[model samples]
Target chain A: MMNKPFENAIDAHGPTVLRVCRAVLGMTPDADDAWSETFLAALRAWPDLPDDTNVEAWLVRVAQRKTVDVIRARSRQPVPVDELPTSIAGTDGIPHEADPDLWSAVASLPERQRLAVAYHYVGGLPHKETAALIGGTTEAVRRAAADGITRLRTTYGASAAQEGTR
Target chain B: MMDTNNTPEFDLASALTVGADEMDSLRSELARRAADDNLLDVTYRTIDTPLGQLLLAATERGLVRVAYEREEFDRVLDTIAQRVSARILRTPARLDDVARELDEYFTGRRTTFDLALDHSLSSGFRAEVQRSLPSIAYGHTASYGEIAALVGRPRAVRAVGTACATNPLPIVVPCHRVVRSDGSYGGYVGGVDAKTKLLTMEGAA
Candidate 1:
């Protein structure tokens, strides 16, 4: 077996995985890093992946894990201070790569709500799978997704529409 | 708003803060890393041609397969998966050299391809037959009996015909240069018209 299945998997679901990474990790270069790591890991495991696997769900799961790894790595890089400001701009810290307005909106969302929105809406997983992946019940995941979507539409969505006109 | 007419799901999914340029860059970056890590197996892409679309596939070794649209590209890919490896991807960069060469060949700017070929799909006497195809030269023709003689299997004329019919790498191998003993255009895997078109293009018709 070669990388055909792996390549096909990438082509079929690259955008969805990117969205999942971006949504979960916020719209930053870290999201790109997570996306690349997910695919690279998938490539290394391509030969062993079963042919009948649901590739979409598989990629989403991998992206989520990679996003977690990215977050962990980011946490390891810190400056000696009493308490780092939650909103560190381009001051003496590692520059965050993101559309500031876009990320701040998503960042404002509650963590579980953000994960619910990302895994369900952007990753295209059902509420059941989202719940399982995020360690919650289906009903909770659904409600989280609904609230997250409403919040995103008001914040990120409205800002995007305003930018498009300008 | 862009969402005025689209479905809610479509609107939500397409309304990402990341623009098209970012997405394109991300895809290229992923492909670059995949190729660098030697994870690419069977990469392919469609190229425009006078004979309709041609699906060009390549492996790390070289250009492995070139398929006509009528070949039902998906079915051809399945064959490649079975014969070569199941790890096929549609990466255009992997086929860039061969595609550019083929484009040059089509436009009459190049007479010979300067790229490597992977003939994994052919074997035995048929493989020998394929090896002899390029010697027939550009703008030239060779009879099946002549091919039979060249491969030192003079009596295997029908077998030669089969070899030509099943030539794994066609244009690169120049199987289109082979004709019938009676100086008639023989059968082609890409159909008689395509064969005729190739011959005409070669100025050997």
Candidate 2:
């Protein structure tokens, strides 16, 4: 066997792992910790994965499960969508590297919507894949993505339009 | 129609590129601080030897940072400064002593590091792995499994590998002193060639 299960899991869903961490933890150090923990868990369990399974969905499911576990264990106060920190001051005295507006918009999303957006857009998964991961039908995943994007557009639409005018 | 100038100043694409560049700068900054000779809150020093420039940073509590051939030493310096809540400056004298000791080892004049290591940043198994690495001795390499065994967990070889991957203090902690039992040089965050060179220099080949 080519270890396709392990390789596919990492290759196909690695970015999703980063996206979930980014969404839930909002660029905090805890996000990195969560990401590492998720991968470590995956590495430990990868050998048992069925060859015909959906690796991306499986990884997302694992990541989601881990994130929830971490949240429950830590008893973190739920950060209101508007209150999450979006821009980290660059560690080297440079300007912030991430697009602050996009990040802020992403950070302001409800937790489920945020996860759906990350899975669909950032993870490059189709609506079906996203639905499978989050335990919803394809239509529900589509609605979540649409709702999330609409909120981002509403929040940033004026700026986007003003730029268009100029 | 969209105006290019009024477009959001930052976005995901820009952030990823900028983050990568920033990380590079940070690595260089750390290296520069390590080479400076002024006494400051953090101990800074550089070692020049056959491998390349090596930066050693320490706090009163313990060794906190090390960088090798780093292009972004400043960022590393800034991170250390922020973490230790101390001003960072150059203190080559402190580092020169370390360099001299390393030089002796490279020339086969010394077999062990006599320097006191400050590892307050690491704890539990991570610290245990680092502590166990030096016991591998010079000119001998141990597998990750073997090191984990020494740490009292016979099955934690992979975790031991992770510990090596995350070793912030590489040379001093001697993560390069570890290898795979299959005789393959496993992953080194500093790059595999660097790992190979360190092993070859140590005569482990």
Candidate 3:
């Protein structure tokens, strides 16, 4: 079993994991932090990963855990002010410049629904794998994702559609 | 972007899309951090030369592999991951010195490469042949028979040629300095044309 260069793994799945992290965390900096931490952890364990592993699913699982760590740390610490704005300059959802309505809608989602939607829909993992990451039966995760999408339609979809037309 | 099922809403995934530039910056930061945290096992980068883009890969020990573009860089990387560790990245910091030295060598500002070389890819008779190649000097040429004799295997001239062909590190290891006994360029790992170009640049051809 030939192992692929970890760079290939990053190139293939970096965007997917970043999207998953951003949706789950709802803040650019924390999401970036989670993204970096997830890949770093993956790199550390990359050699030991079985060659038969689904790298995207594995990375999403890692990102899921790393994002939880960031969330926990966020609650324990004072909110950090942006110190190096230029470094993270091109990021979306940069607070004032972000779509407040969309951000609020996502923030308003129940944690389970948000995670299920992110892991399954955003991360492109199957509901079974998403359920494995977030802990529930696959059927329950499918329902949660469906419910989350419905909630977003009412809360965020209207404004986004109106903005698109205007 | 509305869902295609006659749903009157934006696509959820597109709604959460991260910009391509944003993802690039994030990946760049991770590459740097992976180096800092010492998780980058095989760092690689490419530099353009007269021979075209040359791929350089390094372990923490030193420069591990140098390959020409014709070698198919992706395939070379896969081979490195299999032979070395799979914990590899395209971080260039580790190979900065190697690339700089190569640049200097190509421009005729440097004669000898002052880079640490990892010889993990070669062993036995092949290792002996490669180990003696640098001693052939900058503008000097040696025949396969001469290299065989130098390595104490005068009867192993063909083996010397094989070593040069399979050399993991090429110009840096000075394998091109080994020529045919008839004073002609033999087969080279970077193709015969690259070998001729290097020899002409060194004023040996």
The number of the candidate with the highest TM-score is 3
What tens digits encode model 1's per-residue C-alpha lDDT throughout A1-166?
3324455676678878887886777655677799989988887777777777777888898888898888778778784322212342432244444345555666667888889988887888888998888797998888888887777767765776777842
- lDDT to native, each model: 0.77, 0.65, 0.83
TM-score of 3: 0.85
Chain A, model 3: TM = 0.76
Model 2 TM-score is 0.43
Which portions of model 1 show Cα errors greater than 4 Å?
A1-4, A79-107, A136-139, A153-166, B1-11, B17-23
Query: What TM-scores do the predictions have?
Result: 0.82, 0.43, 0.85
lDDT score of residue B35 within candidate 1:
80
Better of 1 and 3 by TM-score: 3
Which residue window of length 10 is worst by lDDT in model 2 chain B?
A: B9-18
Q: Which candidate gets the maximum DockQ versus the true structure?
A: 3
Compared with the true structure, the alpha-carbon lDDT of candidate 3 equals 0.83
Ranked by DockQ from best down, the candidates are 3, 1, 2
**Candidate 3: which stretches are off by over 4 Å?**
A78-88, A91-110, A135-140, A150-166, B1-24
> Which window of 10 residues has the lowest lDDT sum in candidate 2 chain A?
A1-10
TM-score of chain A in every predicted structure: 0.75, 0.69, 0.76
